[model samples]
Target: MQANTVEQIAEVQRKYEELQQQFRAEAAEREAAAAAATREVEQRKKYDELQLQLQQMIQMF
Candidate 1:
Protein backbone atom coordinates (compact mmCIF):
# COMPACT_ATOMS: atom_id res chain seq x y z
CA MET A 1 0.00 0.00 0.00
CA GLN A 2 0.99 3.61 -0.35
CA ALA A 3 2.44 5.48 2.64
CA ASN A 4 -0.54 7.80 3.05
CA THR A 5 -2.94 4.90 2.93
CA VAL A 6 -0.97 3.04 5.56
CA GLU A 7 -0.94 6.07 7.85
CA GLN A 8 -4.66 6.53 7.46
CA ILE A 9 -5.25 2.90 8.32
CA ALA A 10 -3.08 3.19 11.37
CA GLU A 11 -4.95 6.26 12.54
CA VAL A 12 -8.26 4.54 12.14
CA GLN A 13 -7.02 1.55 14.07
CA ARG A 14 -5.83 3.78 16.90
CA LYS A 15 -9.17 5.53 17.11
CA TYR A 16 -11.00 2.22 17.17
CA GLU A 17 -8.79 0.96 20.01
CA GLU A 18 -9.37 4.14 21.98
CA LEU A 19 -13.13 3.81 21.55
CA GLN A 20 -12.97 0.21 22.73
CA GLN A 21 -11.04 1.22 25.79
CA GLN A 22 -13.56 3.92 26.60
CA PHE A 23 -16.43 1.49 26.27
CA ARG A 24 -14.72 -0.98 28.57
CA ALA A 25 -14.12 1.67 31.14
CA GLU A 26 -17.74 2.77 31.00
CA ALA A 27 -18.94 -0.79 31.44
CA ALA A 28 -16.70 -1.29 34.45
CA GLU A 29 -18.05 1.83 36.06
CA ARG A 30 -21.62 0.70 35.48
CA GLU A 31 -20.90 -2.69 37.00
CA ALA A 32 -19.32 -1.14 40.04
CA ALA A 33 -22.28 1.18 40.55
CA ALA A 34 -24.73 -1.66 40.23
CA ALA A 35 -22.81 -3.72 42.74
CA ALA A 36 -22.79 -0.86 45.17
CA ALA A 37 -26.53 -0.36 44.81
CA THR A 38 -27.15 -4.04 45.43
CA ARG A 39 -25.07 -3.93 48.57
CA GLU A 40 -26.96 -0.89 49.80
CA VAL A 41 -30.28 -2.59 49.24
CA GLU A 42 -29.12 -5.64 51.17
CA GLN A 43 -27.95 -3.49 54.03
CA ARG A 44 -31.25 -1.64 54.12
CA LYS A 45 -33.15 -4.87 54.18
CA LYS A 46 -31.09 -6.12 57.09
CA TYR A 47 -31.64 -2.91 58.94
CA ASP A 48 -35.36 -3.18 58.47
CA GLU A 49 -35.35 -6.72 59.77
CA LEU A 50 -33.40 -5.72 62.83
CA GLN A 51 -35.78 -2.88 63.51
CA LEU A 52 -38.73 -5.23 63.33
CA GLN A 53 -37.07 -7.64 65.72
CA LEU A 54 -36.32 -4.87 68.15
CA GLN A 55 -39.92 -3.73 68.08
CA GLN A 56 -41.16 -7.23 68.68
CA MET A 57 -38.85 -7.67 71.62
CA ILE A 58 -40.01 -4.40 73.10
CA GLN A 59 -43.63 -5.41 72.76
CA MET A 60 -42.97 -8.62 74.65
CA PHE A 61 -41.59 -6.65 77.59
Candidate 2:
Protein backbone atom coordinates (compact mmCIF):
# COMPACT_ATOMS: atom_id res chain seq x y z
CA MET A 1 0.00 0.00 0.00
CA GLN A 2 2.84 2.38 0.76
CA ALA A 3 4.43 1.66 -2.59
CA ASN A 4 1.22 2.47 -4.41
CA THR A 5 0.95 5.74 -2.52
CA VAL A 6 4.47 6.70 -3.52
CA GLU A 7 3.71 5.96 -7.16
CA GLN A 8 0.64 8.11 -7.05
CA ILE A 9 2.54 11.02 -5.51
CA ALA A 10 5.20 10.80 -8.19
CA GLU A 11 2.62 10.84 -10.91
CA VAL A 12 1.00 13.92 -9.44
CA GLN A 13 4.35 15.69 -9.26
CA ARG A 14 5.06 14.94 -12.90
CA LYS A 15 1.70 16.27 -13.97
CA TYR A 16 2.24 19.41 -11.89
CA GLU A 17 5.55 20.08 -13.57
CA GLU A 18 3.99 19.63 -16.99
CA LEU A 19 1.25 22.10 -16.19
CA GLN A 20 3.76 24.67 -14.88
CA GLN A 21 5.81 24.44 -18.06
CA GLN A 22 2.71 24.85 -20.25
CA PHE A 23 1.62 27.92 -18.32
CA ARG A 24 5.00 29.52 -18.71
CA ALA A 25 5.00 28.86 -22.44
CA GLU A 26 1.55 30.39 -22.85
CA ALA A 27 2.59 33.47 -20.89
CA ALA A 28 5.64 33.98 -23.04
CA GLU A 29 3.55 33.70 -26.22
CA ARG A 30 1.07 36.24 -24.91
CA GLU A 31 3.88 38.68 -24.07
CA ALA A 32 5.36 38.35 -27.54
CA ALA A 33 2.01 38.94 -29.20
CA ALA A 34 1.42 42.05 -27.13
CA ALA A 35 4.81 43.43 -28.03
CA ALA A 36 4.14 42.84 -31.71
CA ALA A 37 0.82 44.63 -31.49
CA THR A 38 2.44 47.62 -29.81
CA ARG A 39 5.03 47.91 -32.54
CA GLU A 40 2.35 47.67 -35.20
CA VAL A 41 0.37 50.48 -33.63
CA GLU A 42 3.42 52.70 -33.46
CA GLN A 43 4.21 52.06 -37.11
CA ARG A 44 0.65 52.86 -38.11
CA LYS A 45 0.78 56.17 -36.25
CA LYS A 46 3.95 57.17 -38.04
CA TYR A 47 2.47 56.22 -41.37
CA ASP A 48 -0.60 58.34 -40.73
CA GLU A 49 1.52 61.36 -39.84
CA LEU A 50 3.51 60.99 -43.02
CA GLN A 51 0.34 60.70 -45.08
CA LEU A 52 -1.02 63.90 -43.60
CA GLN A 53 2.17 65.74 -44.45
CA LEU A 54 2.02 64.46 -48.00
CA GLN A 55 -1.52 65.70 -48.40
CA GLN A 56 -0.50 69.14 -47.17
CA MET A 57 2.37 69.27 -49.66
CA ILE A 58 0.03 68.26 -52.50
CA GLN A 59 -2.32 71.10 -51.60
CA MET A 60 0.55 73.61 -51.62
CA PHE A 61 1.47 72.54 -55.20
Candidate 3:
Protein backbone atom coordinates (compact mmCIF):
# COMPACT_ATOMS: atom_id res chain seq x y z
CA MET A 1 0.00 0.00 0.00
CA GLN A 2 2.77 2.43 0.78
CA ALA A 3 4.39 1.76 -2.55
CA ASN A 4 1.16 2.43 -4.33
CA THR A 5 0.74 5.69 -2.45
CA VAL A 6 4.24 6.76 -3.41
CA GLU A 7 3.58 5.98 -7.06
CA GLN A 8 0.38 7.97 -6.96
CA ILE A 9 2.16 10.93 -5.41
CA ALA A 10 4.87 10.80 -8.07
CA GLU A 11 2.29 10.70 -10.81
CA VAL A 12 0.57 13.76 -9.40
CA GLN A 13 3.84 15.61 -9.15
CA ARG A 14 4.62 14.80 -12.76
CA LYS A 15 1.24 16.07 -13.90
CA TYR A 16 1.71 19.28 -11.88
CA GLU A 17 5.06 19.92 -13.45
CA GLU A 18 3.62 19.43 -16.91
CA LEU A 19 0.84 21.88 -16.21
CA GLN A 20 3.29 24.42 -14.85
CA GLN A 21 5.41 24.11 -17.99
CA GLN A 22 2.38 24.52 -20.21
CA PHE A 23 1.34 27.67 -18.36
CA ARG A 24 4.83 29.12 -18.62
CA ALA A 25 4.88 28.51 -22.36
CA GLU A 26 1.51 30.17 -22.80
CA ALA A 27 2.63 33.16 -20.77
CA ALA A 28 5.76 33.50 -22.83
CA GLU A 29 3.76 33.42 -26.03
CA ARG A 30 1.43 36.10 -24.78
CA GLU A 31 4.36 38.29 -23.76
CA ALA A 32 5.91 37.91 -27.19
CA ALA A 33 2.68 38.83 -28.89
CA ALA A 34 2.33 41.90 -26.71
CA ALA A 35 5.86 42.98 -27.48
CA ALA A 36 5.22 42.61 -31.19
CA ALA A 37 2.07 44.66 -30.93
CA THR A 38 3.89 47.38 -29.03
CA ARG A 39 6.57 47.52 -31.69
CA GLU A 40 3.94 47.77 -34.43
CA VAL A 41 2.23 50.63 -32.65
CA GLU A 42 5.49 52.51 -32.25
CA GLN A 43 6.25 52.04 -35.92
CA ARG A 44 2.84 53.29 -36.90
CA LYS A 45 3.24 56.35 -34.71
CA LYS A 46 6.58 57.14 -36.28
CA TYR A 47 5.15 56.73 -39.76
CA ASP A 48 2.27 59.05 -38.94
CA GLU A 49 4.64 61.69 -37.63
CA LEU A 50 6.76 61.46 -40.74
CA GLN A 51 3.71 61.73 -42.94
CA LEU A 52 2.61 64.89 -41.16
CA GLN A 53 6.06 66.38 -41.55
CA LEU A 54 6.03 65.62 -45.23
CA GLN A 55 2.65 67.22 -45.63
CA GLN A 56 3.87 70.32 -43.87
CA MET A 57 6.93 70.52 -46.07
CA ILE A 58 4.83 70.13 -49.19
CA GLN A 59 2.61 72.97 -48.10
CA MET A 60 5.65 75.16 -47.56
CA PHE A 61 6.80 74.48 -51.12
Candidate 4:
Protein backbone atom coordinates (compact mmCIF):
# COMPACT_ATOMS: atom_id res chain seq x y z
CA MET A 1 0.00 0.00 0.00
CA GLN A 2 2.84 2.41 0.79
CA ALA A 3 4.51 1.70 -2.56
CA ASN A 4 1.28 2.40 -4.36
CA THR A 5 0.92 5.73 -2.58
CA VAL A 6 4.44 6.74 -3.52
CA GLU A 7 3.82 5.88 -7.14
CA GLN A 8 0.68 7.98 -7.14
CA ILE A 9 2.50 10.95 -5.67
CA ALA A 10 5.21 10.72 -8.29
CA GLU A 11 2.68 10.56 -11.08
CA VAL A 12 0.94 13.69 -9.82
CA GLN A 13 4.21 15.53 -9.58
CA ARG A 14 5.13 14.64 -13.14
CA LYS A 15 1.78 15.82 -14.41
CA TYR A 16 2.11 19.07 -12.50
CA GLU A 17 5.50 19.77 -14.06
CA GLU A 18 4.16 19.07 -17.53
CA LEU A 19 1.27 21.49 -16.98
CA GLN A 20 3.62 24.19 -15.76
CA GLN A 21 5.75 23.89 -18.86
CA GLN A 22 2.72 24.03 -21.12
CA PHE A 23 1.44 27.14 -19.36
CA ARG A 24 4.78 28.88 -19.74
CA ALA A 25 4.89 28.14 -23.45
CA GLU A 26 1.37 29.47 -23.92
CA ALA A 27 2.21 32.64 -22.03
CA ALA A 28 5.22 33.26 -24.23
CA GLU A 29 3.19 32.78 -27.36
CA ARG A 30 0.56 35.24 -26.16
CA GLU A 31 3.20 37.85 -25.39
CA ALA A 32 4.77 37.47 -28.82
CA ALA A 33 1.40 37.83 -30.53
CA ALA A 34 0.62 40.97 -28.56
CA ALA A 35 3.96 42.50 -29.50
CA ALA A 36 3.35 41.80 -33.16
CA ALA A 37 -0.07 43.43 -32.96
CA THR A 38 1.41 46.53 -31.35
CA ARG A 39 4.00 46.81 -34.10
CA GLU A 40 1.33 46.50 -36.77
CA VAL A 41 -0.73 49.26 -35.17
CA GLU A 42 2.28 51.57 -35.11
CA GLN A 43 3.08 50.91 -38.75
CA ARG A 44 -0.53 51.64 -39.75
CA LYS A 45 -0.47 54.94 -37.92
CA LYS A 46 2.70 55.99 -39.72
CA TYR A 47 1.22 55.08 -43.07
CA ASP A 48 -1.91 57.14 -42.37
CA GLU A 49 0.18 60.16 -41.41
CA LEU A 50 2.18 59.93 -44.63
CA GLN A 51 -0.97 59.70 -46.70
CA LEU A 52 -2.41 62.82 -45.06
CA GLN A 53 0.80 64.72 -45.74
CA LEU A 54 0.73 63.75 -49.41
CA GLN A 55 -2.87 64.89 -49.77
CA GLN A 56 -2.06 68.22 -48.20
CA MET A 57 0.88 68.76 -50.55
CA ILE A 58 -1.23 67.94 -53.56
CA GLN A 59 -3.85 70.48 -52.52
CA MET A 60 -1.20 73.23 -52.38
CA PHE A 61 -0.35 72.59 -56.04
What TM-scores do the predictions have? Answer: 0.95, 0.86, 0.98, 0.89
Candidate 4 global CA lDDT score: 1.00
lDDT of each residue in 1-61, candidate 4, tens digit only: 9999999999999999999999999999999999999999999999999999999999999
| Residue pairs whose backbone atoms clash in candidate 3 | none
- 1-61 per-residue lDDT for model 3 (tens digits): 9999999999999999999999999999999999999999999999999999999999999
Question: Residue 25, candidate 4: how far off, in angstroms?
Answer: 0.7
Ranking by TM-score, best first? 3, 1, 4, 2
Q: Across residues 1-61, which tens digit of lDDT does each residue of candidate 1 receive?
A: 6999999999999999999999999999999999999999999999999999999999999
Q: In model 4, what lDDT does residue 17 have?
A: 100
Worst 10 residues of 4 by lDDT: 1-10
Clash pairs for candidate 1: none
In the range 1-61, model 2's lDDT, one tens digit per residue, is: 9999999999999999999999999999999999999999999999999999999999999
lDDT agreement with native, every candidate: 0.99, 1.00, 1.00, 1.00
Off by over 4 Å in 2: none
Evaluate model 3: give its lDDT: 1.00
Model 1: residue 7 alpha-carbon error in angstroms = 0.6
Worst 10 residues of 3 by lDDT: 1-10
